[model samples]
Target: MKQSLTLSWLLAVAFFAHSQSFNNLPVNTQKPPLHGRHWMAITGKPLAATAGAMIFTKGGNAVDASCAMLAATCTMWDVLSWGGETQALIYNPKTKKVIAINALGVAPTGATPEFFKGKGMKYPPEYGPLAAVTPGTPGGLMVMLAEFGTMSLKEVLAPAMQMAEGYPIEAQTANSIERGKEQIKQWKYSTKVFLPHLGEKREAPNAGEIFVQKDLLETLKKLVEAEQEALKKGKNRKEAIYAAYDRFYKGDIAKEFARGCQEQGGLITEQDLANWKVKIEEPLMTTYKGIEVYKLQQWTQGPAMLQTLNILENFDLKSMGYNSTRYIHTLYQAMNLAFADRDFYYGDPAFPPDEPIKGLLSKEYAKERAKLINPDRNDPNAKPGDPYPFEGKTNPYLTLLEKWGTAHLHKPTSQNPLDENFLEEFAAGTTSVEAADKEGWVVSITPSGGWVPACIAGNTGIGMSQRMQSFVLDEKENPFNVVAPGKRPRVTLTPSMALKDGKPFLSFAKQAGDEQDQLLIQFFLNMVEFNMTVQEACEAPSFKTYQMYSSFGKHEKAVGSLTLNSEMPAWIRKELSRMGYKITYQDRTSGPINAIYFDWENGSFWGGSSNHGEDYGIGW
Candidate 1:
């Protein structure tokens, strides 16, 4: 009888152990997932996430925490700088609405197609002052903090300000500086800040070495002083923050910024600074299987995801099997179709030649586009379709579209070879920030442009944006996106949010240039369709297609090429190759995707930071 009791006990113990296992999903992940009850902060760097946690601990909302994270990452030079542009999507709990922040900078004065053509360029230069747009991130940060945050600008910027004074540099940024020393030496102010030991064997700061930027510290202080003075003059919180914004765009700071830009051979004027404003606009949304997905409007490549989702909705993706050859082919073809439309039809809404966003997002248009998918093999010659007809307008650029389709032939523009890593320079990756609170505030941001090898704009200690290269030189390539002074470029910086049952469902963003929407689409589906946990979904093997034109340098494309996770089965690779795919393998195809999933059943937050990069997350 004692032996029988022991057997029963062992069975019970085994059952309990199985039930207690937290990760019940089939997939294994390199990193453990994060769970939080009150708040969650995730960003590209560890210090940046810590900065967000500091704001959350101070009783600030998600917007405040996100702004703090953004500032800190920019200060750390995590693929960006203070002068980079910011694109964000914020979920305001009070209004129960999602809002898009269009903080992308516009082409400065004298920036035009003719101007670029005169410089003997196919498109804008990839780097240097001539490639810069007017600074937008400073204005973006102040506006987001003032409009939605409960904390003051001074409070939100505390962590970044401290870092600007001096902080131990991480290996990533330090090594990037070392590798780009030659480029850094070309710019006097950049050399002054990035190379502390200019004449040493390693000109850049060593890992863990203290790196300081006195000019940036002083510039931040000047903005704070303006805000404080405004408060003393009886200004409201929002007004006081705007006071700082005014100082940056129209006051002494603007004078220095414009002068420094021109001194570096850029075209920005003080009037350009004053004229540039932060636009808080309505976001575009499309419902995917009862969940409402939101993305910034036409100026960004975000709508392409919506279009891809729309096309994909017609197929039964779940039955095709996860990571199966058929599934990969479907997604690749759908993305190519959507991105082809994006390459031609997307641009700034505030400019002329209005984008047919209405027709592009129409269900009928999606259905028509979906029918074009060749089930047997890849369609390297897939071209943009007529979206205008769905919106009741005749297609005005049909002729250009036809000629462009035949002329491109899925190849890079005929340009001189690059000295840098062509793929990395083509992607021009950035960093992302994700934050959320139990109070219902959610923020998703993808800010980019001024990376290492960036040119610094004089004593302002700000790196100039390299975003002007995103503009097309010829109207036939993308008529709506042709470079013009005061027009925003068609950028790849896309931040995404989702809502279900009238509440926040997921807040996610990533850092790859033209591949942003592609990676995001897979990440979102990994959870919603495959039933994987957030972290599993984040680290899951994903494939990349280069059938669409790149949004960065040379606007290149390689027809029939696909990058799959290196661990993909040999049989799967053979099958894909048989279908006419030029397969390349990478150990990690999931680029730093940071996300927050709302655990409505538990009334908490689940955060996911991919294991591949230095992306980190904290929950409390």
Candidate 2:
């Protein structure tokens, strides 16, 4: 309690130093902002957002509506599938506290560093059954709906079940299927479902064509049947939901999943499913100018945002001028420093060799890290700092850190963000979900894995998670993140929320791999520092740094790499390039940020869906 008070005092001082406000400007956004008096639902796909809207219309709270959106997006394969993982932050109006949902899957049996090394691989494969972790979305959805939501499973899943029966395939998904047909063909069940037009020139479903997943529909029906049976036995709503959850993880669904996984050279077993459980935990938080910002623990990269905020607290970011050379460099340097620590220290807390989360979030520690920044140029060699000392301990991995530094210094630098491979690996898979209702319930979620070209788990119509690729085999890379059975990888998925004056203030998330935190940090600053509305912040031109190791595909990093929006002024780009930075340009560097701002004064909600992708929102 003393430590908390001290930290709060330090943050308060920092906030006061930079409390001057910027002028609110009239801005034109590509997409109009959404205003609502009752509810708001936004996500990666139009149809999925509609699904949430449907639930809200039926009088469901934000949790139930969010569950519906998650289901519909997974069902539509909006860069995710049923066999993927879920990570969420929910604000409960009754408790006035934020709760974190850790539904991320874990490495299955026989999935060890030595096992993958024996396969002549440095890291786990990016695709196929061998890359699978046990599925978590089904269990996660069930737990959330049962505990916080008022609706039954049948009602929440109705839209997704209808989608499973048949829905018009969108161009994005259809094209993705066509592009990945070769990999899809490698898995028999995947080929059967994704390549319905097999032997034809296209081989995949066409946009606007009715795509059907009979097996998936049947799978949904089975879950409903389990819930119905449990209710008939006099079970409560929550108990009935758990019955369905049991059927998915321990009964016929589990059997088929294990059988199909084994058939495809995967490591998942029925035991893995039964042993897996979704954890509802107290989230980590930090105060940025009196706004309480929350993020999941270190098992994810979420805390890096908290760390970044801590470092930025030292600078007068608002006075630095938004998107100015000074602002960009400061934010980039802070992000790199935070991410450097994230790469080395973060992992599943359930594993051994605990992370120094205490020292990492220390305001004093952030000040120490802030001293390492160079005011003139990008630090191509920013290395992880020692947080153990701040926590009253010594770093046991000093030798490893030295060796890691040497290896990183020798890595080749890439100036090209246009490299198709880099972009593909960087953006990767995932989708965001944001919802809020008049009842004061707000939810932010970033769910991913089991995307297109997924390996189907037999006749269950469930795709196996490819999250194992996030694990590193070499301890020199990240000692805490080395692959081991039953351990969760340090994932890139992060959801964000902020509360001001003990009330819901903001709920936001995006669909990008390692860039999620970096982009989100800018989004928050745009609103608070520059006085931009939520919609303007969503569509704002942002910059990205690739200085940290990616969580996917060979785990590579790029030193001094910066991707700026094409709309950025020529003068700013020129100044940035002169500062020892590798500058690249893209028209849409914002990614697909979706956010909901609570208009407490107006007693309403404001929704922002980025124009960068197919993300959409509905409000009423």
Candidate 3:
């Protein structure tokens, strides 16, 4: 009897341990049958993507759904908000053409370099009331929906407004909100929305916890009503969309925004808002491996994507092996080279002509510069090289190159070292949405607003952006990023797409500051050349180099390292170091990158989200 009892007790203990181990096992919630058609969507937050997909299922076109998703994301993901500027890349299968929308907001008219000097400030304020520019989200979304969409603003905005009025905060949303609480507390309006009743610290609102944004809901309703009224006047979708813009820019919303700016001594003016218009410009395009790549112009960091591709083309990437140390070194070299040029020349083309970074992305210029990359040696602190100019006298590209090369080579500079082991924090709280309709029209837009101050009061619920912090006040007493009368601030919000064989091949983008272009280039290479599936391409580890000073500073210059997810192979790191590429093993700091690729032969649409983000992609 004693032996029997002892055996039974041992068995019971063993069973309990087994059960506990099983409970602790990670769950694979990924559903199977993972392929589909009929419009696909991907973004940073899973809930935001689902919301956009739902709109598509309701017979709304990509633009309509994207517009709704953008508004909803601003409320849900405070880290990336609508109050900031936006840049988009769209493809029209009907026209077989790609177009870019520069919805970036301009500096206020009175904004000048002297403004910062007068304030005794050297850096452009990135957040608070000072950093705010004429917001372009309303205008950009309206333009897309008007020109390419089939649904009305009322229909598209209904779901988002409902979401704003009362949607549960997810774990991702809670994390971001908490992270940004300090900045949010500065603005009364932002504080009200994020921290309704603050006391001792407590658990943040979790996933599925209801969050109601009464003010934003009301704002959406007002726009919807105005749009409906315009439609009643026999205005078509385009006109009605403009009507919405007018309601925001010239109507009551504009008045409120202007009033807020004035009260806070901000640069935004009513004229700035009314005069704001989205520019429909030709996309900057280049061919890589017979695949056509399209990116926005200099307004954002779009040109870097082109330059990286140009450098990669010079090497036989496939032969080098994917994600190998050789491949990563090459990629790092290409990025550093392009980034050097981007820091010197790229800016709002609308800015003064003398800005040093223009024409860096010209095809002739790219080809010439691509030859300078040396595959074997890692020029740790490599200086920019002069590529023979194709345009005019002085060959600004070569001139700037020569000047920078001499300064870089001879200057007593500290080789800024990066913490090879320091991990970058993943920006998991933003959102992205992409859609295409049967009409052969595709729209991709990403809305973000974290790290900036939030106005919880007034229920503005929108988060602030730190983009303005990148601008430098010139020695000539000019505010390089001043909120001037009609000038938009420099931004990193670049959206991209690709075309192959005259069809929509890829629509993808991310929301990180400099990593946007780096990630996009990788996606393009992964899809067009490596033949990786959409999911595989997006899930792959990525790297970025910020060796030069851009509108964003060179603070991370010494940190010439790649931030890779832990999943990346250790051998790859060893190889990269051997090739002179500094390796920074990060858990995941790259922002959420979402992509959709259309397989012309398969007649199927492939969509996938980054493994590092809280986003999802689904189709039906």
Candidate 1 residue 183 Cα shift, in angstroms, is 1.3
Model 1: per-residue lDDT, tens digit, 1-620?
A: 44553343334223323443223434446778899999999999999999999999999999999999999999999999999899999999999999999999999999988998998998999899988998999999999999999988899999999999999999989999999999889899999999999898999999999999998998999999999999999999999999999999999999998988899899999999999999999999999999999999999999999999999999987767667777889999999999999999999999999899999999999999999998879998888999999999999998898788544334334352222455675567799999999899999999997889989888998999999999998988899999999999999999999999999999999998987899999999878876768887788778998788878777777788888886676667898888988877776887789999999999999999887789978999
TM-score of each: 0.95, 0.96, 0.85
**Which residue segments of model 2 deviate by more than 4 Å?**
1-22, 406-418
* Clash count per candidate: 0, 0, 36
In model 2, the clashing pairs are none
Please give the lDDT score for candidate 1.
0.89
Leading candidate by lDDT: 2
Q: Give lDDT tens digits, candidate 2, residues 341-445.
A: 999999999998799999999999999999999999999889899999899999999998886744432144455344667667877969999999999899999
> What are the lDDT figures for the candidates, one per model?
0.89, 0.90, 0.63
Name the top TM-score candidate.
2
RMSD of 2: 6.6
Q: How would the candidate models be sorted by TM-score, starting from the highest?
A: 2, 1, 3
- For candidate 2, give the lDDT: 0.90
Lowest summed lDDT across 10 adjacent residues in model 3 is found at: 420-429
lDDT of 3 by residue, 1-620 (tens): 54553353334223322342212222221222135567765666666667777788888767776776776677665356656656777787667888888877766666676886698776666456666566777677778778877788887777677788788787766766676677666666666666654554742455567877776777777788888888899987778878878988898877777776566556667887888888989888778877788887766667778877876777777666556556667787778888766655555667664443334655666666666667775666665544324445354344334545222121222353443221122221235677665556677775554343453213334433445555555522122333345665555667888887888888888766556777778777765655656765675456665454434432234435455554455555665667665555555533466777787787777776765656666677
Q: Kindly indicate the candidate among 1 and 2 with the higher TM-score.
A: 2
